[model samples]
Target chain A: MAEVRVAVPPTARKGEVIEIKTLVSHPMDNGFLLDYGGRMIPRWIINRFEVEYNGEMVFSADWHVSISTNPYLIFYTVATETGQLDFKWYDDNGEIYTHTAEITVT
Target chain B: MTQKSTRRDVLKLAGAATAATVAPTIATAQSAGGVVVIGAGFGGATAARYLRRAGVSVTLVEQNSSFSTCPFSNTVLGGINNFSSITHGFGGLRREGVNVVRGRVNAVDPDAKSITLDGGDTIAYDRLIMSPGIDFKWDAIEGYDEAAAELMPHAWKAGSQTNILRRQLEAMPDGGVVAIAPPGNPFRCPPGPYERASLIAHYLKTEKPRSKVLILDAKDSFSKQGLFQAGWAELYGDLIEWVPFSEGGNVARVDPATNTIFTDFDEHKVDVANIIPPQRSNRLVDTAGLADGGDWCPINQTTFESTIHANIHVLGDASIAGRMPKSGFSANSQAKVCAAAVAALLAGNDPASPSFINTCYSLVAPDYGISVAAIYRIIEDGTIAPVAGAGGVSPSDAPASTRALEADYARGWYASITADMFG
Candidate 1:
């Protein structure tokens, strides 16, 4: 589980390619380290990161253990209308962390 | 930035005050030497106020526009205290006649007795005080860096990180496991992590119901452990699980890419992880050459003068204080002691023998609280030794009324200490 923060222009002109940024708090434990007893640390990283705008897939990435904790992602998307930008992070634990940011377009 | 007063104005005010009271050690009949204090946290602010009252020309420099206290920040995570309640401004110190400068002091030139600001401004002083507090030893914890902190928030600094951790806890679903990895000894607030678990469990018990708190401690035991255990048993039951160092509680490493915590024997994949790294004196000590080959500065127990630097004092978390636990109360007490010593030293007299007191109260639940208090003395050998049997913690399973009373006391202590530092 993580707290999600997103940055998007509050208002945009139609067809503008606006930059969208997102951040989430997580450990992204890659299962490489040892536990207190010298056992291997089981990995549980966010394996998939995706973003959608107005029912269209705007951005996506297949992440690995290299993706640090509190994953941050940024991409460009055309402002076609006033709609919500949806974000979902899929982890090896089968947990889905979701967030949404609304954009207003004139 | 607040307007700076001329040295003459300070001397004039000091002269007027001295005429009414017994003259303190004075570099002049009108005023004492100028003292420059760095990092206006509890220690610096308290020293500034007391020095100004003692008629010493003083300037307090701080990098932050406002201070966010770590003492009661856990309450913000529990929704028991508002974020603004723990944040303070420097307007109070300025009004009290302390020249409060807002800037990042970049260097301390010991021989010259001066400090340099980032923009090339230099401040000269006869005596200087630094209480820059602690910094994270990022290398000690593998894969945990400043950027990774955004992913695995420590919330140790009590600002943006605290907010981030709180939001993570709030966003966690029912039946989720919230994990905490508390750093080893010599860190700030000896009993903080447990208090956080207690309050977080209280919040979860009410809201999430099925959630649990897993505490992985670096030590085998902790301050007030018995009382905390008793309270958890009586209130939270199985909602809290503790793993001590003896049983693989020590965190060997953390991976942010997976939100995983690794111990020597086992690995935990948690829903939310709070990783607090080992600490050292703030990096400012390195630039000042004050930390004599250690992570913390060594100070004269009697006067808090840094052993490596003459005419300079270090107080609070950045210095080694034998038996004192790093808490807001401890810092406030040290600052007052340091202020008095600085005044006496400037006035051409040795400082009076120092005695200090610290009381830390923790809330286990909104209505349940416990406390620990200690009295310290600078013995003949100059070690800050706690008076034998002079301090104790609240009794386990105290009556509900007593717990509630202690909760009230916790609130009162917060108000009183903030007043002492910033009022």
Candidate 2:
């Protein structure tokens, strides 16, 4: 499974466009290269990524093989209320790697 | 069977790098020693079981109660297996006298001989056995980061991504391209990517005969190359295409927007992909200063003890074990060697100079398999080198019966290794 990390302000004003930065710990094995001995290393990369705010989808991406390992993303979302922001990375292999952060909105 | 390998010849390596760690005191040497083992995978779990059985008080610390294994995971990628079979629990190890604890090991303080858990509890040990295994070098590949893992599956660790790749294969349109990107040297299971390609191709051949599996390799050669290629030719025919680095196999970047991988030679569009990036020792292992700013921890191959630290031993993929592939069997073998040393060290006895062995079996299909095995011992140069002519790979032209038998051995090895570790 991938390790997803998120950085968000502890407090945000209602209706603020909060900047959310996230990082995931993954090799993103780009099933393209060979080992030192010249064999095709198997590819097992994450292919879909998504983020949600309080159960509402805010962003999603259809990813392929070319992405950074432990890929990081920064995006802006409106802080409408005190709720949890969920971040998820979907693996081509069929699992979802997720992380969440709680934001206190005034 | 070498004429020159006398006892003196073998012991020369021992003299070259003799470990200074022995029972510090005679009176306390015979007492039951405390050992804290971290990570309940092949290396840690096996060491915990063996050390506890050797009359040492062992604390097996793991973050999860259940452990999914990587040895048999290619079957999952082939679409013929599931997680339940490859995953296991620690009940057997606990019942066998190891004090198995489910907690995150937050920190390992070598000087204090103690480990702090996430909840603030601490467990001290006479010796620490760290089998934290390999972690990806996050930026080894351009655009291949953790966030992109969800976008590209590196099902190397044998967890959720195992099934993810299968689902992707299932969802791919018939005749769609399935591209696999394997990691480079010193990674786990050197022959894994080829085996994966073979098995996935089997799935495609059966489920979607028009589909194809493309392997983009970082290296020009691989372990059991003749065997894997032969298997591919015999079984998969023209369905599998392999591009080596000399021929533009290396991917330069990945763009999820188009589900495409750009290689030095050309850009590949695929319906699904497995992008395995570069790897190194786990982050925590390096954080503990065990790796000493290097990609892998340097250890005395004779005792598997960190040359840079005391009262600590590293096993499996984390250690710089020369000539041994980073595989589960190697970890288990290394764990046994480490367990003996830890037990002997605490008991105030001289640890034995141990021999290491590894045999990795990969299935090209359910009833067909290939293997590479080696017997290793420390050499006069103070390295863990393979014993000359001790083992070899399955014959590329071996009869079907031999391949079938290797397949059975693969299953047997999985069952036995899991039992040896967890129990």
Candidate 3:
């Protein structure tokens, strides 16, 4: 877990589709490159990222080694209630990163 | 086989007849609808990709293939990275179905909608997009030119010249002097040359303790100045010497054959000189009569359409995007807005007002980074202005955690921009 940036519109209409972009900062190392000692760094990477609104999953993605170090995900979600949008990323080792953003629905 | 005409056969025949009559006319119209794009860098590449995606054929003329990149060139100079790691293939553009031609453009005829290549091939275009990044004003420095670059490598365009400068730095004596001369404003990457200096200083402090790096800059302050200074103080204090223009560091000339750069009131000779020259729009824009003055192409900030030429759009470093620094991130941002406008105009829809964004990151060390971010909107009068309080630089006296986080943010910035442009 490194850094998380969440972009939620300041206001949205209820039940309207709104775009939200979340970018998380992590090495996402696939253990491919050789280290200074010429030994391979073990693969330790985030395998899945999910976004939830009020504890209900809205968007989820599975990533592979091909994804760059820091993964930025932009997607849309239907805004029904004014609540919190929680973003969580889980690594292969079960390390979880949680960040939250407050959104308002008119 | 068919004594009576079947419905399928009759429908097929009618469709074939219609296609036969319409196809030729459409083919002729499309062939005549040519596009000339200047500069084959990231901005040009994206525009070419999207235009091809939109079914508009393009002729992308670049002065060189295998463009070396300034983004990660510091790693090469520091001996931490190699050129192959940063090099990219144009085959991606080829796969996108673009005509990527390698040639220097001599002139542009906006009225005639024609471009003359260096080899005398005249190309006519219905629309022209100029993304030719930047060019140095040799006159800005009294004794600097292509010849002077032999020994004093700007390495700005990132190719063999970059390698030359890197090798020169590597081969210098442990105690030798390395001078980096950064140009004034309206240049590409306002924070880049400073970052390069910091990276070089990092290498010197670790590998050659006796060596020193001098940054002679033409500006009073720089992007991430506070953060970079703090890092330098913490990491390599007294190992790096920075002199702004007012302090007599402004470069006046260079005699590369003698390895000397003359400034007002003093002459500093060094073992290696990295001169980042003052820049303007690429030469093709000037040839096309699109340049207003000061090495920039003036365009309507709203649509990125050239004020000097009809049906021509200019984006990226080449355009005088007032208040927007010439950076890779800015270029990509401008490209997306331009793409939307082009798509709309082609679809017979009104071009929407465009908004641009920029976030520039610089590495002060391997794990330390700083950034400046801003969101801009086109004003009603066709000018671009930063949205008040939308984004700003990292705090000057940030904590260790913030600095470390900025390093990760820098990587994220790279990923985002590459995805927007090439992915």
Candidate 4:
């Protein structure tokens, strides 16, 4: 398990664009590196990230080995309803880490 | 503002004033015809190039035909880099109209504004920039003189010493103990000893897993301590042990004949010994009377002019720069600022307010890296101070991907900075 940090405004005017920023800690170890014993360290990384607003998919990204460790993402979406934004990070090892941020729009 | 903007402003002013000084120039400004920079290391070379870029005639004197940078030399020790890869020539600087003179400067007559070469030639200068770097205090550690350095190598200066240490490591048998004795504070590259230890541990772990590294440090804490220790534990686990000064880590004596280091409470006989003794400004500064009875040269933060002497500037590891570590990055930054100030002085203009920046990256493993960075400016008291919240070390809990990125960035930095220097 890794620590994740995200920033989002608590409230926004309806139809106004809002910004969301996120950071997560992960090794994202690409398989190319050699260990002390001259063996290749296996690749383990977060390969996909997606965001949902009010149960609707608003943004999604496919991450690769080239993505930096501790992946950080910043994106914008229009405030449509008073609800929550669900953030999910999919790892290469079939594990999904998720977080939720609630937002009020009037 | 940032040092980048400051440098741009200085360069802009220098460019605007170039035509005015072009005809008379630095050559006609003084009887001797231009600026003379001693040493061709990071500080002197950058200063000479920048001055020449501003159309000032500059002569750079160096004892060596080529220079090997101290930065990235540790990678050589870790067997990941070749010595020749770090060595650089002066052709780029020479091509830029810098008068690259290869010879030993025997003496500097500050009053006459002239320096004497070993072969009896005297080069006069409108101003002198001395960046002689550091020289060890041979008397600081017993039995660790120049002769003993051949055996118990310091490898602090790079070049041949670096090769010696690497060769010693390669020749040592499995399970051999390598003892590293680092000096106290205010030395060149504060994080260097620890980085060396980490790289050596990397080499041992790869080829000789039975071998271990013992760091007998003179300080209780070191640069990027938490990050380095965490990386060590995660990568080389139990292979690298650091002994702080409080716990009999301060080396009192070195008996190289028996390959042993003696402290107040204990003695260790190791397979390989690296004794980095305390250091001061290179002997050239002492000979030129620039140190003013001190180990380092004090300078004006804004102009880098020697406090004790007029028309003489010092930079690099030899200078007492406030809040700046004596790293190559600091030297290069100081050199640019000092060059601008010197150019402004020659043009009878007050130098642009100077700022500096330094970023040092150390590799704990081939794929793991950590760094510290800072931006600095002169405060009201005429001393350099780091901008609040402007810079800091890499986050301790950064993911391995972040470390890998830093490692790649470290390699990129080496290529870019070296090109910046040599070009």
Candidate 5:
């Protein structure tokens, strides 16, 4: 299980661009490193990240091994009739870390 | 990506200007019994804090509000630490009653006993302590200047350059050649380039196994050579190769346009190049005449006061302290001695004799660490000399557990030392 954090403004004016930021806690072990015992630590990383605004896909990113640990993403989207924003991160081991935030748009 | 471009642009500007000119601002006043310390890195910050603790009014002026240390910066390159983890602010010093000003010092007037900031504000001081650190000898390497630095980053200053090199490494393809050209002896952090080589090798091992690290050196020997080589062989095998000066390892010039390094005998077209050119004390030392027609400031060993100037002291990498390697730990130790001397002079008291200690820890891998430490004191010749039998390097034959323990201690050392300086 991974921990996720999301930042979406609680209120925004209609037709105004709003910014969203998120940070996900993951080691993102790229499978190339060795452990204390000198054995390989298999590749583990968040492969995809997606954002949903009011049940519609707004933005997404296809992440790779180069992404460092505790991945952070920030993007902008126009605020119209904001309600709930859902963030999802899909990892290599089939784990999906999710977070949701509520926003009000005038 | 924005962060990368911004950092690159900043380095480009720094390279373009001999003395970077910041926006002018109104100068502040310094009261009597005040001490102004330039540079807020390990040396200046420690001296300012200690001066404040000694009941002396202090002002610390620095161009950057935050400091990123060279120590453990290798961890950032190795992917073991984040840039933010090593970055620190001056909030702790403010709480200690030290006036922390954010600006670059443009001039030092020893006669007036005052220093001018970039914007033309001059602050008077009873005593001035400088720890401005190192500036590269750009002319030493043909075709290697600030613009070329944009392509082949030095990453020696530990903030933006550090990131640029790491990004280049990340963007490099597997099996690509990464070249690191270390300067001759007496540069900052004698073991720094080698530590960088080790950690960069660590990164490529896990992320790009086919890639290799190539070190083209200007010096035939380096600090902790035996220990670093032993660890390199044990962990990285032949992934890292070192070329000494005798073997034409000295980089004569670089062609950044082609990503190539030309030595006396061989020209290597590397995928990524880190050229750490020769270094001297910050240009301010030369401008202020504290270097006394030499590359480094000559200071009185007992007080760290410049022998050429009255009431002005030099500390850290800028000053020529006998037998002391240029290191963050050395600077921190020197700052204390200088601080005590400054405080005594301000109080009209003879300064007490001082002894210095330095312990430099270099991480070879995430779990493997090695160190060289020494205790120094003023000898009869008025120069600093290491106290024999007081310190030694890590044993070459240490076990895995011992190496791991030293690794843990290295992290602990970074945490505590930064705290002592910043606070």
Candidate 6:
């Protein structure tokens, strides 16, 4: 599993539609306690995520246990203004992980 | 007799003048009846002062003779301030003509409008204000109670326990672990445990680099998450370990004998343990038949009058102030609104629409601070909601100078709150 990285278009004209990419570092281990050598290993996984811009929802997705470790997601949205882009990831256990990046449109 | 006044007539005039001088004093004492206020901390002290300013006599009943604040207690842990700096005398309140009574209230009778002191004396009041703050739910954490606090200090209420925790931190050997067990939701000062971790980590980085501060949080995320994470990353990234509730951080029990905290799956033995237990309204509120459920007294949002009883107002941590975090600032704000309503009722005037403001500041390091502020107004539905676009967390990517200014603002906020409440 690699670390999560999120990137948006480095430069975009004002009001231009651009792509935003996000990748997270996690092993989406589903809760299936499997015994290896008579030892139980509890499962853990990232379940869902959403993207918002300036307090408005832009894109979202739901994931399952089978979505491989450190899932990367990408989406497109029109840059309307200079504001914040927020990303939130939730694990199967309802643990929420959030990150935000700034976008300035010239 | 007209030309030369008789001595008897002159004496009669003197007697009338003396009676006139004494009449207003007796009348004021009768009309300006004193309110018996329990708890002389932030909320009670503020209410007493404001009531006195409104020409209402006040008798402040406090268990302690002096006041010691929990606000900025993290500074004491960080060695920035001592207990003396936070300690204040009640002389200022006394100078305002408030009768400062030092005794524990045994019982409160709403019907009788009186409070029974532990010394077998009863004080009657036209109105009673109770702000006894929080009492720990000792049973929530097994093997932990008032007796255990001497060794395993919670330090949540601040004073001696705070000093004890600071001393323990100083006494720990290098590379030792300082475990801080934060309670669940509905605790006083939601951001408090995190701030304590930051300040302790600050102390360790300079004095004992090899030492570590472990935060065993019962919740997932806390106030000002981004700012705290940024400070941790910049200052002591690896030295501080925060284990959330999903992990093995949820503490269920503690054995004070061995200085060990027991979670569901593991036992953590630490050099020092600051266990902030689950909290509820003080015992008086519960015993007075005021608490509705969840160990807090429910009240009407507008007047802060108890939902169970009429003409009895409950403010501060004892009241279930909806949508407001249990903080000193929130308590102080609510007390002012409550005071206004009480005064309006006394004057036979309708209470005005009430509003409140709260801004909580947390110092992540000596030079780094963060805050969350909100302005709240009572809606037509009688519930308080944050005024939109009024307040929020500090921007995440703010510059170093902004962070430094935030530190100064944090100090200023403390001074302002204390002044508003006590000064």
Query: DockQ numbers for every candidate?
Result: 0.01, 0.02, 0.01, 0.01, 0.01, 0.02
As a whole number from 0 to 100, the lDDT of residue A39 in candidate 6 is: 60
lDDT of 3 by residue, B37-70 (tens): 7776667767776666556677787877755556
lDDT of 1 by residue, B1-423 (tens): 255899898888868877665355434413534899998887898888888877777899999999999998999999888899999998888898888998998899998889999999999888898999999989977788998899888888889999999999989999889898899988988899999999999989999989999999878789899999999999999999999765557776788888898764467988889998899999988987788778899999878999999988999999887688888788899999999898888877779988999899999998888999999998767789889988888877579999999999999998988888886
For residues B237-295, write the lDDT of model 4, one tens digit per residue. Answer: 99998987655577878898999997644689999999999999998887667888989
- TM-score per model over all chains: 0.76, 0.75, 0.72, 0.76, 0.74, 0.75
Instruction: Please give the TM-score of chain B in predicted model 2.
Output: 0.92
| Chain A TM-score values for every predicted structure, listed in order | 0.90, 0.91, 0.89, 0.94, 0.95, 0.82
lDDT tens readout by residue for model 5, A1-106: 9877566778999999987767666888988999999999999999999888898999999998898776766689989896988888998999788888888899
Rank by TM-score (best first): 4, 1, 6, 2, 5, 3
Minimum summed lDDT over a 10-residue window in model 1 chain B is located at B24-33
Across residues B132-154, which tens digit of lDDT does each residue of candidate 2 receive? 98889777777878877776889
Which one wins by lDDT: 5 or 6?
5
What TM-score should be assigned to candidate 6? 0.75
Candidate 6 local accuracy as lDDT? 0.82
Which regions in candidate 3 have their CA more than 4 angstroms from the true location? Answer: A1-106, B1-34
**Clash count, predicted structure 2:** 70
Of the two candidates 3 and 6, the one with more favorable TM-score, higher being better, is: 6
Cand. 1 Cα-lDDT: 0.86
Q: Where does model 1 exceed 4 Å of error?
A: A1-106, B1-19, B22-33
Residue-by-residue lDDT tens digits, candidate 1, A1-106: 6676666777899999997766666777888988899998899788898888887997899998887666666678999999898989887889898987889999
